[model samples]
Target: MFHYTKLDIFCNDVKKFADADGYVPEAEDICQDFSYPDTQFKGLKNWTQHIQSSVHATRSAQQKLHAWQNRL
Candidate 1:
């Protein structure tokens, strides 16, 4: 499975989903390995649903928290 960090979340990019350590997985890998609960989508529809998900909001907040902490 591919691991990703908040920095990898790109709503407007074709090549999305990167590892926290900066490894960008291939599109095929992403399709085969990535799974979100109760949803099956592709393309812009997938991105749209993702940004609206609770998981996305939570992760985004966590990312912000980490950034704020680093600045301190």
Candidate 2:
């Protein structure tokens, strides 16, 4: 059985992979369209939230995929 600690490590790696796989940059591109482009405060905050949620959602999907694969 995979431990929860291992799952965390997997999620972290998934996040890194998501970054390298263009998930983060895509989020940045999307958030770039927001009104506060010049300011780091609101834009940064918005993109940060958006990117984090995106990565988290992708990671969860990957986790479910792996679980399903293992079950099969």
Candidate 3:
């Protein structure tokens, strides 16, 4: 009999349940041999999101500032 572990279950489930083209590489798979939870990558995701949001916010503020300057 084969010894399929818990991780094998998650990978199979994630792959199966994931939507078409929504394939997410398992973080655990990347860190080692698929041995961590999805939350382990949360900080990286959060950092990227923060940078993107900050850039967007800065651009919007700059646009408003420029418009105000033009009016002055």
Q: What is the C-alpha RMSD of each candidate to the true structure, in Å?
A: 9.3, 10.2, 17.8
**Would you list the C-alpha lDDT of every candidate in the order shown?**
0.42, 0.48, 0.38
| Clash count, predicted structure 1 | 0
Please provide, for model 3 over 1-72, each residue's C-alpha lDDT reduced to its tens digit, 9 standing for 90 to 100: 011222232234333222234333322223222333455436766534533543444445446556766785
Checking candidate 2 for backbone clashes, the offending pairs are none
Sorted by TM-score, highest first, which candidate order results? 2, 3, 1
TM agreement with the true structure for every prediction: 0.28, 0.42, 0.41
Estimate, for each residue in 1-72, the C-alpha lDDT of model 1 and write its tens digit: 233343344322322433334333433334334444334445755644544453454455456657776885
The residue-level lDDT of candidate 2 at 22 comes to 34
Best by lDDT: 2
In candidate 3, the residue pairs with backbone N, CA or C atoms under 3 Å apart (3 or more residues apart, or in different chains) clash, namely 28-34
Against the true structure, candidate 2 has what lDDT?
0.48
Clashing pairs in 1: none
Quote the lDDT for 2 in model 3: 13
- Best-to-worst ranking by lDDT: 2, 1, 3
Off by more than 4 A, model 1:
1-52
Identify the superior model by TM-score, candidate 1 or candidate 3: 3
